[model samples]
Target: EPEVTQTPSHQVTQMGQEVILRCVPISNHLYFYWYRQILGQKVEFLVSFYNNEISEKSEIFDDQFSVERPDGSNFTLKIRSTKLEDSAMYFCASGRDSNTEAFFGQGTRLTVV
Candidate 1:
């Protein structure tokens, strides 16, 4: 069986610094996405990347955010400038197609101070 893997698991950063969250999903998966949960809030979709470009994105994915696959095997999300409100659990997910179920990583807990 294959699953998504995220690195660092936990991260603490200064409010003004930049943070990069990494994830690796099943090799055969074609769709990848980033989502976040702010403590008591619902899991919110940030962006979806497919075919090497962003396929969809939520308002939450503004100018401060960006994502890329630096290598064919890894996907990453970068926050240009962290904010206190950015503290949350960020999850990486992947699926075979738009209609298929997505498998999620445990998540990287980010804390900004």
Candidate 2:
């Protein structure tokens, strides 16, 4: 079974620094999304991408955050300036369609100091 894979399972960065979290979603999936979970909080949707453009985004996905497909196989989330509140587990998920089951990656834990 194909699955999403994220690099650098954990990352430590200083506040105000930039971080790029990478993910390779399932090959056949058409919709991709980025979500973040603050320590003990619920998973929050950041943004969704389809057909090489942003389909939707939440308020948490402010100007500091950006998503890109970049190529045929990889999806990425870039945080231009990290803040203490940016520390969380970022998950990459994909599905064949919005209504189908989405598969998630192990997630990249980002720590902002």
Candidate 3:
């Protein structure tokens, strides 16, 4: 079945550099969300967006992180200044509606060195 796919499956970056993780979400879904799992911690919601403007974002999605559609099929997350604490598996999710279950991508492992 068609699903979201992320590039570079794993990324290694320095403590203070830029990185952009890419994703291709399900074509028909509307609501999009970004989540991060730090090793064994609970999956934390970073942000949720619909129609471009952010609908909701948690404290984790601070000024250093930004998300964008860029084009029709791609969704990207950019970390302007990476930190060692930012190492985690970042997942992109999509749902048909606001209250529906979201399907998550395999995830892009971000490892800040």
Candidate 4:
């Protein structure tokens, strides 16, 4: 079975530093999304991308956050400046369409100091 893969399963960064979380979603899926879970909190939607453009985004995806599909196979989330509150498990998800069940990656755990 196909699955999403994220690099550097765990990352530790200093506050105010930049971090780039990377993911390779399922190839055949047409829609991709980025979500984050802050510790025990519920999973929160960040942004969604399709056809090489941002389809939608949540308020949490502020100026500090950006998503990009630099190539056909990879999707990435960049946090320009890290904060202690930004520490969380960032998940990459993909689905064939908006109505379908999304497949999620194992997630990248980001820890800010």
Candidate 5:
């Protein structure tokens, strides 16, 4: 069985710092996405990437955030600047295609103080 893996399951940072969350999805998956859940809030979609470019993005993925596939095996999300409101659990997910099942990583809990 294949699954998505995320590093540094927990992270703590200052309000104005920067953070990079990493994830590795199943080898054969073709669609990748980043989603987040703020404490006590609903899960929200951030952005989707495919064919090495952004396919879709939500309002939450503003100028402060960026996604990259630095190589064939890893995907990364970088936040240029962190804010107290940026604290949340970020999940990395991948699917075989647009209509298939998507596997989600355990998530990286980010806390900004």
Candidate 6:
């Protein structure tokens, strides 16, 4: 199975630092999304990007965050300024369509110090 890949399963950064989390979504998929979980908190959707433009985005996706498909197979999320609350498990997911099943990556655990 061709799965979504994320680098550096764990990351430690000081508050206010810049961080870019990388992910390689499924090749044949059309929709990509970013979600996060704050330790024991419920999973929250941050943004959804399709056709090179943002399809939907939650309030959490503020100015500090940005996403881009740098290449055919690479999707990346960048945090211009990391906050203490930014520490969470960032997940990259992809689906064939809005109603289809989405597959999640193992997740990139960001720790802000």
lDDT of 1 by residue, 1-113 (tens): 89999987999999989999999988899999999999998999999999999999999999999999999999999999999999999999999999999999999999999
As for TM-score, the candidate ahead, 3 or 5, is 5
Put down candidate 3 lDDT per residue, 1-113, tens digits, no spaces.
97988887999999999999998889998888899999999999999988977899999999999999989678888999999999999999988899889999999999999
lDDT of each: 0.97, 0.96, 0.92, 0.96, 0.96, 0.95
* Cand. 4 TM to true fold: 0.98
lDDT of 2 at 2: 90
| Residue lDDT tens for model 5, 1-113 | 77899988999999889999999989999999999999989999999999999999999999999999999999999998999999999999999999987899999999999
Clashing pairs in 5: none
lDDT of 2 by residue, 2-78 (tens): 99999879999999999999999999999999999999999999999999999999999999999999988999999
Worst 10 residues of 3 by lDDT: 69-78
TM-score of each: 0.98, 0.98, 0.97, 0.98, 0.98, 0.98
lDDT, model 3: 0.92
The runs of at least 3 residues in candidate 1 whose Cα sits more than 4 Å from the true structure, single-residue gaps closed, are: none
Model 6 score (lDDT) = 0.95
**Model 4, 44: alpha-carbon shift in Å?**
0.3
What is candidate 5's local distance difference test score? Answer: 0.96
Candidate 4 segments exceeding 4 Å error: none
lDDT, candidate 4, at 77 = 99
